[model samples]
Target chain A: MSKEELRMHWEDSFDHKYVKLKKWLIDGMTNGQFRFGDRLPSENMLCRKFDLSRQTVRRALDELEKEGAIKKVRGSGTFVNRVFAQPQRTSSVGILSTVLYEYIFPTIMFGAENILTSAGYGIEFGITYNKVENEANFLKRMLEINPMGLIIEGSKTNLPAMNVDLFREIQRKGIPVVFIHNQYAELSDIPCIIMDDVGSAFALTELLIQNGHKKIAGIFKFDDVQGKYRYAGYGKALRAHKIPIVDEHVIWFDSYEWLGKEMNWVFEEIAECTAIVCYNDQVCIKVLAEMKRRGLSVPTDISVVSIDDTNLIANLEVGITSAVHPKEIIGEVAAKTLIKMIEDNTVGNKSYSKVMPVEIVVRQSIANRKKMEKHHE
Target chain B: MSKEELRMHWEDSFDHKYVKLKKWLIDGMTNGQFRFGDRLPSENMLCRKFDLSRQTVRRALDELEKEGAIKKVRGSGTFVNRVFAQPQRTSSVGILSTVLYEYIFPTIMFGAENILTSAGYGIEFGITYNKVENEANFLKRMLEINPMGLIIEGSKTNLPAMNVDLFREIQRKGIPVVFIHNQYAELSDIPCIIMDDVGSAFALTELLIQNGHKKIAGIFKFDDVQGKYRYAGYGKALRAHKIPIVDEHVIWFDSYEWLGKEMNWVFEEIAECTAIVCYNDQVCIKVLAEMKRRGLSVPTDISVVSIDDTNLIANLEVGITSAVHPKEIIGEVAAKTLIKMIEDNTVGNKSYSKVMPVEIVVRQSIANRKKMEKHHE
Candidate 1:
């Protein structure tokens, strides 16, 4: 580059609209290099030196403040991030989940954190909570921040196309995005991090069948491919055993529910059903809690099984038995695959699918009905 | 306030970097608005009419995408957010938890979602994960796209201060920030959301005494006031009953188990105590898991009481008894106060410590040691 161009580049770098003044000071200090706890010049001095508005200068300083590059006391002045080094930011990955209100998201997030942190990725999350706009807003925001890779729990539908625009944006920007649960049907070529919902559901249903539970129910929500896959597995298990699919035993809600009224209706309808398998741990908790209220002890008078084991059940007096969702593995795979996608720019390719298996944790929660013929409680 | 200024704002609204050319088309639609499902004009028209580079013109459409405002198919152009009530935003409040990996941060965030969503605020999050620099970066990025408010879980001793400089910048720019856990000690006037650690700790200890467990062990992180409060409370609880504080039973690990191998030595020292009360849930989880490996059962052989009850314990098989932190209330208060700070531009006020009471959940984990002669399976 010419000397003039070099000087121009230097000026442009110094004149960065977002962090102009801070950049200049830090660059100037680069030779002297500000160490931890180095006091920054007062706001007035910075404003005067940069010939920039106080607000513009504040932006750079604020960035510095958040970085702990500097500390600011109300009456006192700004100082530097005392413990900072040349930051090694690679170990951080972003996890974008559906919602924050749902227990499943946080529980699944817990698992993801365990695997990612153990494998050396710091976990950060953006909560979509099933909203397309928020998801898109977060995505646009995410593009600007850019983590190592991203794990996105795909919506059942194609994000109604709008909320999904961010998915395309994620693709266009060459950021890796691994879809969770239902793959982005529209973007079928992208790899997804998933669970063995089909296998886990089949195994749970088989367990119930082996335990002599002929009258059975599969609890789920409508419109989700994951839930649908579980239902299909349930069918596969029942069909193999020569049992007809009972329409009455197929119970579903528009959303996840274990409310007393909802459970009561199910119980009243399927009075003779001996066992129930649920989509996730939440439904299982509700089912058990409702069953207990009705004086129906688990595994004795009635047996209950669920997909998705969570820390929630581990805290219960009677431990819940069921295969847990592979949240961590799925997160890791999703994170890794997304990073790969970002590197390869594989947004338009055939979507990838991942199905992790679940493990049955047996302690209590499920018992054979035949053992309770002459017993109570 | 002036007519010329109003005109400038009107033009600026349309000309700002974020403004999309499609907005102009949408505005020009019949009845001065476009209906849902109405197909937008082609990009050529946008480029020609707006006199913008295709890259610049595409941003307006991009906003709609992330927001799920419009749907786009490959070979097909963009459509609107299908659940589109004519471009309505989903109601959500975003939380910026410092570190997503920590157990306490999740617990607090869980509470924030509970209160905010119920109050008609949608939940979202930006994670600094306790890195002051990362925190600053996220703050700048978040500012670029404003959320309703932010609930922040801050870092502990010697960790980077969150964009304190940026937070002031945020205040200058009229954004609300609720600092939770570690609030700026020097900036007492800054709005913060936190629990009454001392009160709750004292209460937990008192509860143990009331439950008839006197020979107790206290565990906490050495730094941070929360630990100090728990220690003080333990001392207070002991003093209330005229029992001497057992110096040997107090265990503190200051530096990320900077104690590492010596963690065992500390654990061994505390094992002799009959009843153990921990500062928070993570410490409880670690301590309890370690104890079980050593063949000790909870509540029966050694009653363990945990502070900060999360859903993990309530649904746990062992039923860890714990004190509940008012996450939603704290988050709500912090947010409201931050908003106030943002609006008022006030400086130099001490944090109004809102000491909420902690409820002790009587779970099976806290056992009556006198009744257990055998180990729990």
Candidate 2:
């Protein structure tokens, strides 16, 4: 590299450090942490807090002084200027969810980020790992930063939430929050962008019944509202057809209990059933693997159906019948709703909360039980 | 009193004590503070915590066992029954605000309570004393109860908020929250039922300008969004009329700074002005009293205009021109909005967040500068 290029790079680094330190000081004043006439931290203290050199800290302080945001009293240190200490607004929104890489979350995040960034707003992303405690911590951190809006997916929504008070406080502070996927039963007023879980589950179950498959079994997650809604849809479809919901054919497992378990027990409970409805593509893959282990051919010995038409089942010889999750579209809608709330100051409007319809994709997963019996005769 | 009557009264008191203890235990179970199969507190612990006799605590435990909510073993401690330990939904809403007795809050509360109670929903009321810390404490307590919805008047809304995370957590939990009067700038999506401060302030200022008073002085609160909006309207009116705003003639104070202060300095800064615009009727009262102390007559020496045509200024000899505060109407609308959100599950709709229009209540305080000049001629 040329000497000029090296100097430019060094200067850019120097400028970045000072600009960051200057913003910290300004934020302190804007948020009233440093009120007018209040003394600022010493040069040594600033350097330690921001982890910058004394020269960089001095440059930041100098810029503040020049702009009249602070006054330097050589003996007394720096004080916020009574005249120039005013609140500054930020155009950033906080985006929080359970996980980014797992399931369809990456697509959702990508869709939301694209819209928010293009609209000239910065994003502060947070992950909760589906824990209420982590959600509270992230929310607390976000509130301190005071973003203009928020788009969040709830953590363990089917359970009694422990972090709802913090959510209420955020609303009280006038921040617009929009939820994607699921929301807590306690905060139904906050708009949520979600696919029609019940309808999709119903459609998947109906597809199985239409193929002359009766005595069907279902495996569902018990700790999330989405699972409950899907179960309800399955039950509704069964009831509509005058089919008795045999308790022995239904199984429930939470997030932690579903991993690396013996599938023999699950199959044993539903041994007499002709078909099974898995909760999603992820669960369907597990069921398919378990069937293969038992030397059972898909749509020959047993049939399968589920929700979320994701690529997880792409490599399987038989494509499982499933309903679309509307992954990216849900994210885009959530982001758009949040942005509308922010720009229009209509965060209180419940109309923006929407339920997207689902479409089912049929594959070679279900068997024609009636046709097979007639051919045998 | 008869012997039977006296005995009945004693029995009623005893029943109430045991019933309260039973309800407390059920609440703990329903809110997941105690999970299924969790051991119950010892009789001695319950007695001590509830300040009840051992017999009353034992009776409460017996009731739980009879209702199949708990199982008590002869030698072992009592345990929550796995089958019966399910979440029991409450038909109650939490109402939070600052200073229920001050200004128009009592009327607002009355309106909300009337509607909520009539709709068969119970009320949980909390006061914040306009402090964010108190707001947080109340919010935490309310979240534990997990009310169906929340109607809150934000505390210290003009300043940087400290309890917004709690609010966001509540929203994530699916509780609907509505704000009244003022809301924090950070959470603008939470529907707020408020009078149009900007429009009213403009009309009030315009009334002064129409009376031929161009050199106008104004005083506003700086810590509330309402104050900022009112100030905006005042500025807008001045700008529209092509009048330069004299910086020295305007003053801003927060909730804390406005109490028990001398107004001589205020008058000194605006001595040349013929009329002063006050933020609210409360501030106008203070200003009027100061004018009277200085032997200045209303409309003769100086005129005043303000918002909130409340009963606080009813006893004044000279009626000050002001804007009407919706008061109970705001409360009714807030309650209706909350109930709609709860019943229709439309809390995410921004259309419900309303800005109530303001009307000017023409009183006797404005001085006609043109008429006074003609009289002098």
Candidate 3:
């Protein structure tokens, strides 16, 4: 069919002019009007035939070319290619998580899916399960795919170093990468989305102190970067309140398995304490269970508080008072900032990071021992 | 400086041809060698002078042009524009959540951020706070930003319809959108990442029955879509064991606030039951607290179990046995599916949904009442 004939068959129901033009061409091709090796109308011809701009015609044609519906010869003209039997794999973004099915990671992954998919990009996902070797392997595999961008949740980022050169190699290859939750010290040049762990931890400790708790115990993770910062905040809060950092009251676990095996250490730390500051809800639960086994009640015998205002704490009848982790905002900000870097084509150009603010959630796990003292007096 | 002079000044340490060219141009401009509004050497001249291909020279020029360092007039050669004062705002992806700072949403937001940012796209976030009006307003506001794509967590999606028209309008406008958690009935055409609520709830209920608890009470939410599906699962489990769905033993709460005020209902329901099935950890906690107040111990007087394998129950001394929620996997799959739709440009073209798999976490809350009866005999 002639270009004019094809233009006349275009539907106006579709609001997008490019979409309408695209549909018309697709319909004509499907009906065998446009065949293999057939030369389609030139950009100028289509502009006039459809009463459209050269830009609009070119856009429709560009899409057609991408889907292998057409091909262009530099000095010649546009010719119809075969109708694609299989869809093409376009540009993609990769997301590497330490753990894929636990805590906040799932939601973060879902959030990323929402943005990337809508923007017409594919996703490549990998799980490190918080292991250094797994992270290395995942990064290597991701490099082979060479996605448009990469999102990495660092594994054991609290350690002095691991996989810095691998991350640098990705940058050198012109691929944009952003870190989530934690980042390595050697990879300081990389942008990361992090929680305000220090501040929130400090606030949680302060909350316990305000309730008249002089002896406090702390449980922290040794492998994650957030644990270090949170511990720092814990120390700051203790120093600020004129309470010495009690060495015996502090415990650090390397992994969940380690924590499970070292339940005795938790007991040792909490023996002389009136309040306990846990690394997260998981630690809080373990400590609570142990306390209950020994016939100790929450807040009355000793107050309990932790960071991360998750359902774990929120679901309790008398919920564990917590300092909120700005989980969603961290995801949003990190995605935005990284995208800005990629679009600006300045990946590896400069370091950018965001520390999201947190809030304290008050609940029944924290009690005012001062009130009891007044009754005793 | 002339093209030959610039070529002679090129450094050997820079690996990328574009990087070398960019650095040369920047240095020349800063040193007044290439002044404001000055025209640069032609692409052919640079290729010849630097012993590079025309493609290489052009690539360098493209980078310079993107940075606003040079402008090419229709007939005129490329000339210096100006140093970029600030980076431009690139295309953005939008995320609309029911609540931005709440438990699961934050992590989801963070995950999305990790993906979007790395791909070189910014994020525009909005929160519905689980209110229909808020959802409508956020959707409308998101339209104003004209994001490349959208990810929405539906607000109370079980009641048939609320924002169907608004969501349809978004799809009609050619913006890709994917839902998380729950989807409205009228908008079934849109894809959603959901949990296997029915199967998981059934497993949880079956667990209680397996422990010889014939009388099982239930607490659920009325507004959220998951509540209904979970309730269905609960009934199926009971019927499988030939236990009637006791009307008085099932209580549904609208909001967390409602659950707090309706403790009496929970107490009443559990009065004659040997076990209870809660919608989530929050309800489980409330029941545990009430049970404690009445001097009732878990798995002794009554067994308490819930869905969602979060730290809330995990941290308890006698943790609540739970059916795990595939939180991170949900995000990953949802984001992947949505991206597939967008990249294929099939927005509103097909219906896609994924019900993530779940696992039951066995904890100490459940007791084998059959053994207790044998002991009594």
Candidate 4:
């Protein structure tokens, strides 16, 4: 056909009533007004809404089905198709974290990067240093990039987030964001991949209790949800064992207060405790350093147990009995969930949130106080 | 004083009427209610608000002045001191950008990093890749970190920003943010260090017009404010020279569409023009490659002019006359401005926004069309 004829034909086809109806449906799905697997309005409803004829509406629906934009499930209704609803403009995923190279963050990032790169998607990565302000900045940048999906390790998950509006805006724009490690309570509808902090801390505390250590002191972080959950677990274990939970035996520190003086203060508060449960390996290491300075030996003077079985604990003279953190697994699961949501064009699908179970890694850090008592007798 | 005596004295001192009034003033400054250099309430107003006697209020003002938290002028009321208002918690600043390694970004980052590091402040860095989503993400992260200050190159600055709330929140928290390169129109209140894009583009285009080329084709980016300004300058230059602006000779492409095929399409649109003005060095390089593919020689066949005098143009077989981008200088100014704001504890101060002047470098790209016409005769 001549160029003029092609133009005329294109204009006529696009100007058709059925084609206009189809465009409206596509626009709705693209904007997340109609998400993946969502049932479209009844044919009669669409016809009335668009002021179109029944035959035109049916034609539009049939055309959409042919194009894989929707599926008609026999007797039910037409549903938005997951695969076809995806706007594959850029094959890139945004990955955000509080810390990229600290503690277990590197492994988590590596895990997510492996999955994303192997799937032929580029990565836009950022770190927030566990600060809500930094999280807000990174989220704003992510919104500008408009990646196919986002996988983020939330910052200060224990606190109320001021960036919930940004998260909601992202979802409204049809870009799925999956939380790794934890999520904001305000945005609880978003899917997440997280380790069971409460369960892990419970198991760790129980192990110490099983070793006959009743006088246990807990050192926990106050800024993150994981820390709160771990503290709860510690309290739960002590309660279950009928041990008195002394206020003086609990030491709470935020991200900024983990200094030499803070460690000394922690020891002073828990001076009479036989065992200590730390928030993480970093805290455990600090406590151990303080013990060493005081010329005390682990398991002999005081037993130390913590969560996050990082390599930092392995380098120590004495092994720390702790609960394992699913670092890389959290990243991998988060990436997979985000990719699924992106491909399916689903927004704020809570079904994808997975809390992995916990496991204890026994080491020499825990001492059997009951055995020690028998030996003394 | 003895410990008990000291405690008693502290309680007595703090419980005094003047001390309570002093605490309120400090709190106002801390929360950004009273900014640096802002005039505090009059002594009479403070007395009325606090229901304190004139002597008590005078004592409070005297204590504040003695501590350098506020300054009292002979005729005016006391003002918040810039030096004393800073909350010196973390010695770090966050630096955000759209691209880190591309074009002039590295040098710009280097300049800022040098200044920030030399000042004994650590850096928290992130990039948004010219995406609004990424900008939102990074801004959120910056907010969480609560860095002393933030230096950022805006993402998709020509468009309406969805991250303005995030920026406003950062300011509300009293964390100063300085924009490098360009800023969002919605956030015009934020300080920025940017080059004169409009004047530079105008000069570049006028240079071509001065070389006696009238039928000039222009290729410009559509997504950034820089592109819009550059296009405006180009049109202004054409109009100044009494050259009729032809719609067919102007081409607009966004961040996503500057590929080989797009360049070919651009050329097809401006096939009749004798010379071309490009958006930047990157676009100019692409145009050069396309012309080479078509076996057209620069200057001998058609002259090319562009902005951003990057090293890429220096390596070309033929030199292309372009405007200098002030790459590193932009970074230095941004860093300095941010540091000043941070130390002063000022938020959203527009006076710090610096629009650096532009300069053009004459190269071998332009052909003397007038000379060619006379030689043909």
Candidate 5:
């Protein structure tokens, strides 16, 4: 079976003989005909083996690649598709989020990716940009990559038809998936890593109270899992302390992805509260930047504290007081869990949850409320 | 061609004939037999027509997939591979870097990704993490994803053997890969994007001199390309002003990545200079953080400026005056050039290079040299 012989067969055959070869290739992968990083013989080898031409052989391999069948490593050669190659180790989970370079997502995702990668499993990532279609598309690609488990940053509920389809496909394919930060109650079977929002909010709020700040302010993002939880915590903390939660004191914005349009609005709201708690580190960073741009100073005119602990925030020019979540811990657990499910195919219908302990790091962002009457918008 | 017939064909010899059928499927895609986004007939359709079983029919179709042949949408019928099926206008370009999330990588990478994505071309990304293995691995993988071009963030001069082999393979395959941020000046005829370090450094130093900073302090990373030009610039600027740069004010931190282990030697030099211009933003940020950790304030106690215009510096609590490079434009031009090479396969034998522009953003980090002396350690 050589290239010349194969070209002749293609001309002679009105039969669909190619389909059988596809199964053979897949069976070869499942049956260990190829190892994870092993590149198969060139199309020439396959052509000679099967009396086929180079083009015919390549066509067969190409489709497997498209169907998440194999990974064609250019220059190195084509290898067995790892997305479906090995039995997934709990450490080799995949993550798909709407954004990768955000304040919170990285904090959470890096934790998971690092833990998993350290445990000898690789983690591949996809970004969705908060769009349902993109999420669905990313989901499809992730599945084709054949990760043992998935950790989606946002809730799977209220998504578009395509997103739902992707989730359904993952389930149908028997792949385990996890939701993180926030989730839908109805999706209880899906494991998740969530923050203890109400508790954290209450704790920080009490800190403000103990600092003698009655006119405290809360600034956060809206329409997100973490944002809602932080807000709820703010409210619960206020109610428990017998302090009124004034809507005016709560200024809201979305994720840092689109933070600028609301800067002016935040300026108008700054005059209302003695102290401010930002939703995450990025918002706090932006607030500080904008305020400086407008010739305003922090702690002197307005005291501020933020949530989210990045590697460098503690040592920043302004020591930011923050509630830090153990992102790496959560990431490791998710990877481990997904790997377990992939290996045994028995991470049964249970919604497991892990909440890493969070504590506030007191920095320079907060101070006792001052009697300032010269507040200008 | 139908399911019933394909099942019958499974019992036949699994040989050359299957290869032929696979090519026809591909030929169909190339010949406009199946339009872009159009799904081929079902497995069952092939089964009946060829008198092959579901298994055998799949084998023939499988071969059509492996070589970038086609895309098989789950639940939907398999579609022709976009390489031949879809037009190049819908194609995407990719960006690959080592440790993309670190220091200035993300800021520069993001700027590039944003610009490319906004231009109606999809951008795919990969992080090589300064590892030759990872770099080589990603280089192959990036090519497999079929990017029109690539923007490599670091110097290829440092790549390991395997990576070098693969990179050469990329050139052999006629795909254009452009180097950015770091220069490949030694390698004749390598395509690259670079900053005017000699000119910019001279400018940066002139700023320090103009601000009355004769006893200037410098902490730098001693990399050949940027470090060489920058150091030269500083010397040239000093010569122009009839000022001598005291060697004591110039301290070379071999790397910030080494956790400042190499910086112990620099402690003695900080107090000598009134103003310190750093090699890059990462060094500047780290030094700033270290200084704060040591209870020193920037600009007030010791003025600082650095290279690289990343948002990381912008997000810093105190703004540092620094040179900003045109990162996104670099990415765009690199990608466009690579795409051209990939398409025309007409890369010249000589290396090509493009020098990107830089801007000096004056922030609060730099102050008059005489004023900086008051706060010098």
Candidate 6:
């Protein structure tokens, strides 16, 4: 079938001017009117053929391109996705989260579902609860369901490999897999949507430094990929400022200890520091509590800042001056990426990795220490 | 079947002491070994006959009762649930929440899932995002699915009637409905698992009074059922202590406006109050930030107390003294009740309404104003 034939079919398929042009493209591809590697009608050609706006034509083409149903080259016309042209559309995508309905997962799931549903896909979720047994159970269920694609927010991305074989098996079954939040260390070839942890942390630490604080202590988690990047960023900011990165000023703890009894020691160790750089809002909030317990005032006796500005943190006593978490956008991008991989049959290819941008949120947590010193003098 | 025959079956079912007795009971009914309203063997008789521990027998019976497979009448033997006798087991229950990922919802959902899954039921969640349209959409979807039961965390419980007809329709389909956190005004016949808002708030306010606070101001949300109860409790505490509930000291705002510019007015209005009683941790945190900006020291220039002791409040600049939210227990109780209603086919019979207890968390936010006055003298 030629481009002209496909154009005629699209125009004849509907009476309304607002006919779904994207669906027509998919229908053409499935019926062999547009075969693998066949060039789609140019945007202007599509607009003229269908009597549609250029914007409408481009939008349809863009969606097709996004889902791997079509790929656009800089100088060449868009081609049908070689992988997606043959298979029928799968009704549902499977999503696995460590803990559903908690912290940021619900919003992420919500965002993903909104986009996926609009694109004619349903979501089936399984909870791993950050446990190996639960992970195994969910993986087994995913295998049974054999969903169109799988999106995993792994239970512990840094742990010794456990579900590597299962994930590999999923890929072997022709199901696309995309990881979010944390990716498995062993599966480096898989596409991932991860945070710009190092850059965001570096920016956050630099913000504190720019606020005139020299003695900045850090409270970080040591059990995941994010913690390492955040800690390194803190060190980088200190090095750039020519401030000594003292070993005793750093407190390395896991998620379990944020509100745990070890908080007393964390506060005691950071006593002499003028500013505190925390890993996330949960840790920062705990540090603030400890500061209050010791009769220390925030941004006065000591300043504070962290990464991931959550709602709880935003509405806190000082509305934590920190970095914003792009959870919704991450979900949307990750969902779109996975769907594209599924459509194009590019699940096994190590062709995509996204590090979404993070921005600073200026609140009341940080203080100008130099001004305080001047006032004291 | 006779008691002897039932015991014989139980003994022959498995070798492991930790056998799945609940499945066996369901199987017995399906296979015609048990019938509707048939009285089962006494716990002691079953224990003696099957050579099983009384604890195991009771445990199995307890689960059967929760799933509405049986009922234990005082001074009589346990009888099979009449409604559960004929229908095949439904594997899933639907849950709807206004927002699923924020605040204390994650923990509540976690608790509910733990109980439901253990009892062999799956959860299908719908998020209303606190919008009427979304609520209607979810309700329509739930009706199409015709789930075994429904657990609703309403969009906005205090709003004018919108979902009452949909809820009534669910009951008409013979599907049980249970509400959590808040209940709709028109659906008085449905069971609800709500917080003891008034009692908890009274306790919190009484605590502040005991600590020598007389001039107490409140920042409350007026758009939910819980807020109204909490406000009433606050008033009750004030009146009981002979402290006037001043009009200017009370600031009423909605959930949408908590982080809005109206907050500036909230801070400005509460300037003269020595102690501020907040709606929840989120509000308390905001109030604290405002105090910091105005150079008012917590427990010194002013004191604070609030409802719902969340992680944010626990780890604040001043660990807010608060009334705890029983979200987890509420979820557990609500899920169990809904399951019972589903199994027993009691969709419209008002058999349950639970108000889970709340306790006070004494932290540093509340100060002894009388003691401070004496010290200054």
Candidate 2, A33-80: lDDT as tens digits: 886568999999876655568999899999989987789998989998
RMSD per candidate (Å) reads: 22.4, 32.5, 26.2, 20.5, 24.0, 23.9
- Writing each residue's lDDT as its tens digit, candidate 3 over B215-304 gives 888887755778877877887787678775555566656542344344765586468999889898877888888888889898898898
- lDDT: the better of candidates 1 and 5: 5
Worst 10 residues of 2 chain B by lDDT: B81-90
Clash pairs, model 6 backbone: none
- Tell me how candidate 1 scores on lDDT: 0.62
Error of 5 at B237 (Å): 66
Candidate 2 at residue A137, lDDT?
81
Candidate 1 lDDT tens digits, A1-377 = 65466445646764565455667656644433554445678889866654556887788888877865567878877765442222322445677777854666665666667656766667677876454435556676776665556777754331113344456655544455667777644566666667787788888888888766777887765435576668767867886786656655766553212242257767776787888888888788788878889998876667777777777677877766687776656655665565555445344244555667567777676676545543645
Per-candidate count of clashing residue pairs (backbone under 3 Å): 55, 47, 28, 52, 64, 0
Off by over 4 Å in 6: A1-377, B1-90, B348-350
Show where candidate 2 strays beyond 4 Å: A1-377, B1-87
Per-candidate Cα lDDT values, in order, are 0.62, 0.80, 0.74, 0.80, 0.63, 0.75
Residue by residue across B123-230, what tens digits does model 1's lDDT show?
A: 667775444445556677766655555666554422113245566665433345666765644345555556676667777777677666777888765434466556
lDDT, candidate 2, B1-377, per-residue tens: 55466445535674687887888888887776775567899998887665678999899999889978889988889998732222454788999988888898889899999999999999988887676656777788877887888998887575445567788877755578999888876688888789999899999999899999999998877656687678778877876786766656766665544773348878887999999999998899899889989999998999898888888887778888999898889889999999888775434446778988879988899999999989999
Model 6 chain B worst lDDT run, 10 consecutive residues: B81-90
- TM-scores of chain B alone in all candidate structures, in the order given: 0.60, 0.76, 0.73, 0.84, 0.63, 0.75
Error of 3 at B312 (Å): 47
Ranking by TM-score: 4, 2, 6, 3, 5, 1
lDDT at A43 for candidate 3? 92
Off by over 4 Å in 1: A1-93, A100-124, A143-148, A156-162, A256-261, A315-318, A342-352, A369-377, B1-377
TM-score winner between candidates 2 and 5:
2
Query: Candidate 1, which CAPRI tier?
Result: incorrect
Candidate 4, residues B211-231: lDDT per residue as tens digits? 889999988765577877787
Score candidate 3 by DockQ.
0.01
